[model samples]
Target: MGPVLRTEHLVSADQQTGEIASKIDAALTQLARARQIQRQCLATRHGLSPLQLDILMTVAAGEPPEPSISLLARELGVSQPTVTAAVITLERKGLVRREPLPPRRTLVRLEPSGQPALADRPFVDAASRLDPALQEAMLEGALVMIAHLVDNGTLSVARTCLTCRFHRSDGGHYCVLLDLPLARSDLRVDCPEHQPAA
Candidate 1:
């Protein structure tokens, strides 16, 4: 016979809620600190805003599709005008260039100047400057939460492992794109190869 279930072994709703809330708060705090560090680094070292840096990195990644205004807007979950504004600012800074396509569309690409900027310290590296254990815990929790939110459609700009087309689950979940096994802890909220599963 199957093992009998025990109601007493289950966690109470209040306990679960408290644990989830605490974890979320801790994760969010760490993420905000990391973002702050990144923003400061970009502003001080590169004379760029966080949005500008994000745009540059997205273009450099070259995933989902080519860097066009519409595509970028959709990927970033921002208005077309917001992306256009950032593109124009980046163009003025000589970091990005817009090439006119047929009809009314334009393609954006990073210029030579932008290449060096992307090589600078990223937030994850910056986070390492803090307490190792704290950083690791915060990042791990944040990744899991973000992945959950993305999978549930609460977050628009992230791609989750479980929802990607390349995800396989024979014995364990794995990504065929990378040809590597995936541990539950290894899942990411932002995988470049992630294609929305049909």
Candidate 2:
């Protein structure tokens, strides 16, 4: 008898495309759901909207000197006006303050009352509610992604700093980096490690 031959069915190009489209749709749906859940968590426990909470957390995590409106906006991926509005709201609530400082900027810091609200058991417990392993993994992933963005210039490491506005240079040489007076002309220069006055 002649050798028997067998043929297998193959997916058509349209079928393959449909499968990919379905996967993308599912992924988007999950992302939307996750964002909604996070928003609800912030609203229910913190008595603040997600944007409000973000503004508070941003100020809380600022460097010892605190951060200005422009710097905070850059860090939070929002516009200056958006940050300004949040700052105004926080100030009215006595949860933050706008201090007058060098560069003539608005500095933000969490008030004493705000600290307790953020540090309360509910807040801490809500944060702890997430799976530790998952949180760690997400943090690692975010770091890696941020590194890529920085390298690509999609994100900047050099924000407002000594050269930007906050740094007040007196006459005579003074600098941990160059051991010389930093000229005002160098303001536009980018320095990743620049530290501005608090």
Candidate 3:
């Protein structure tokens, strides 16, 4: 060989691994502390548990102005009983109401008292702090992630066929919301940015 290669030319693998580990540890610690703060804030500000706040937010973001317990359970990745317990607590606090839908299904929605909590200043402040472009990018990324999760069976669609505005429950199959015919393939469609009429 013309010249001996030096081991010093190569970077230390251990150093690279240590850097990555440090980053990961920092991320986990931050997440844990944030979650603790979130819990405490909910308890102190709204007098509600974190799960109850989650349930309220889920209903507020749902398609039909309200969501069933099954929908909440699916969205939260929890058992029906867990959702039921949260709903019961929310109801006791007058934060949510369970209304009887036509037929037998029950719809859960935020009570008047809960609307202010749902529109909490902290969430608004955080959203306002984000750049519009960054917010849009984040929403798009979330949608992509949700699609991937559903495709991989890690997430489940929860809204009922009839409750969906795009679903044609009557004899004809058309979406009143879209003002077009409905396709069978679009049954489980959902959008986080969907807004209802004023």
Q: What do the candidate models score in CA lDDT, each in turn? A: 0.80, 0.62, 0.66
lDDT of 3 by residue, 16-48 (tens): 888876985697688669766866686669888
Return the lDDT, model 2, position 40: 65
- Candidate 2 TM-score, true structure as reference: 0.50
List the candidate 2 regions with Cα displacement exceeding 4 Å: 1-36, 64-66, 116-142, 151-198
* Candidate rank order under TM-score: 1, 3, 2
lDDT at position 43, candidate 3: 63
lDDT of 1 at 198: 60
In candidate 3, which residue pairs clash?
none
Candidate 2 CA-lDDT value: 0.62
Q: Where is the poorest 10-residue window by lDDT in model 3?
A: 189-198
Candidate 3 TM-score, true structure as reference: 0.56
lDDT at 21, model 1: 99
Q: Give the per-residue lDDT digits (tens) of candidate 2, residues 1-198.
A: 996655455677999889987985697688768766866675567566666677777677656324788888877788999988978887887888888777678788789867744553343465477787755554444444444555577866544323233444464224555545644333322355565332
Worst 10 residues of 1 by lDDT: 135-144
Clashes of each: 0, 0, 0
